[model samples]
Target: MSQSLQAAAQRLERWIKEDAIPLWLERGIDTETGVNIERLDVTGAVDREADIRVRVQARQAFFFAQAYDRGWCPQGKDVAQKMLQFVQQHAAHPTAGGGYTHLMNPHYEVIDSKQDLYDHAFFLLANAWSYRAFGDAAALAEADRLIAHLDKKFGAANGGWLEGDYAYACRRQNPHMHLFEAFLALYDATGNAKYLARTAELFALFQTRFFDESNGLLFEFFNDDWTRLADARGSWVEPGHMMEWVWLLDWYSRRSGRPVQAYLDALYARGLAIGQAPSGLLYDVVAENGDVVDTGKRCWGITELIKASLVQIRSGHPQAEAIAIKAVDDLFTYYLSASTAGSYVDRRGADDEVIVDVAPASTLYHLIVVAVELLDHCEGRVQAR
Candidate 1:
């Protein structure tokens, strides 16, 4: 690694371990409920009255578990256990068969009991991470129960699961993408071939239902039959999702001995071509025809880019190391706050103005993932040098 990149990695490690993780644990947790607070203002005040989404709860749990795994936070296991207990207590549908509820009020009352694929996927992820972090048998059993419930309730005839009960004419690929992520984590935690088999099935669905061979972009919405929608939603593409898939596909290949170079190359090229802004940050949304639909840049998108770049660099992609360095530089320059110590500006408009003033607790997961990956990358590069 270049001396500059090595220095950048060190800075990121300090920020995550010393600033971000501690800040979140202190201000982002709801002490009364033992659940995660939804957001923190620029001044680091918690949003106490905000409606807590189950996915956010799960993501925060996953973050702390990951932080513990990376040795960045000593109290990560305790935080994760608290968060997981809270989720199990309040997030489950009270009268419904077995899936998690969508949202809960500050007082831990279920506000929305609608079964959502996205929420279930994150619930599974939270369980997997909790099991891995603390050897919680209940967490693993809950993961299995959630998987069975998802298959029973939301299973689609075409292969992938349905979005939810409120599904319109189009089904989204986002939930399935997350399920793929959750299954991979489950397989890693339990050494279960069933999870691996399920992941492979989702990958096949990505090729058949999600990926657009015509333009190399992944479509966001599909019809009831898994065909791409003909309208604007069908043409919508997210660069973040492409980069995320690139990272996952690479991981899958390494673990399963699957050949995914073609998909990876196409996704990487298309992501850069359509998703990248002049600022070197990823645009929020683009049309399949390469028009910028939403000119917003989000913190999560940049994190996905960092992850994909690191994966590519490990694979010896010629330009990946430079791309990863530039991404790290941008992350520090625009997203990381100068005065807030640990908080970040979550969204910026196309003109580079701050769109959201408050930092989201959910974003901590993305930031921690990038920091962990960069730490390993930098260490490997130093040893190689």
Candidate 2:
């Protein structure tokens, strides 16, 4: 790590800790109903009418739990538990099967009852962290039960899980990536070999299905049989997913002793080469062969890029530190600092115009993760942000 990164991180930490944390805690949660706010308008006012997605609720719970574990907020656990309570109370699938619904209204009604794989992944992740933050036995039990529900509802006869309760024509590696992430978190939180075993399966799935060895890139959409499923735009790739996998592979390697350097190196190189805009922002989507599929950018992708750069810096990549520093600066300048305090610009268009002005609650997970990763990398070298 360079001295410049440490300095830049300290400044970023101040923004995250001193400014952003309090603002979200104060305005992000509904005091009366306990529903996590879905988004904040450009004026930093909460969107009271937007339906809350289960994934957003789960992610906010995870953030609060993580904040508590990291010693950033004293009441973080209480807030996390409150959010968890809201989800469990109202978001359950209206069927006999376990797992949660896809969406809920702010006033505690289930808006969508369809069981979604992506939402359940975050449900497991939130519970995993909830168990870690306070040793909540029920949280661990919920995660275990949810895993069973996933196996029962979404399990694939061939390999990897389905899109939801009903099989979809297009399978996504993104939700599976999140499930891999949740399994890892569960393993870390509980020291359970079963969760780690689950991770191993997902890792193998990534190698055999999600990853493309021919181009050393991961594609987004896939056919029912896990074949490439891009439309007129050729194999569509998200630079953010590439970076996310780089960080995740490093995470898996830490526990499994897997040799994943090649996968990491290839993804990182290709993403930096073809996935970034002139402003250094990772575009929302790109074609397999170095074509820009979408010129738009999103806040979550920037955070993932920062995390991947941080992982590279740890692995002693030559330019990793500099890249991470620039990414951190860009994160604030383009997304975090540019918007209203406690809120962020969600997406920017081709011309770098703010297209979505509300701060989606799901996005807070990405921001908090970047902040936590930075704290881990720069700890002890500098005072707490």
Every model's TM-score? 0.96, 0.96
Residue 41 C-alpha lDDT in model 2: 83
Q: For residue 311, give model 2's deviation from the true position in Å.
A: 1.5
Point out where model 2 deviates above 4 Å. Answer: 380-385
User: Can you write out model 1's per-residue Cα lDDT over 1-385, one digit (the tens) per residue?
Assistant: 6776677778889999889888887888877777888888877787776887878888999999988988878888888888878777767777668977888787778888888888888889889998888899999999999888888878888888888766456788999998998998898898889999999999999989899777788889988898878888888999999999998887777668888888888898899998999989999999988899999999899889988887777667898888888888889888896367788888889887889878888888788877877887778731221
Residue 355 in model 2: lDDT: 89
Deviation in angstroms for 203 in model 2? Answer: 0.7
lDDT of each: 0.85, 0.85
User: Model 2: how far is 80 from its true place, Å?
Assistant: 0.6
RMSD of each: 2.3, 2.7
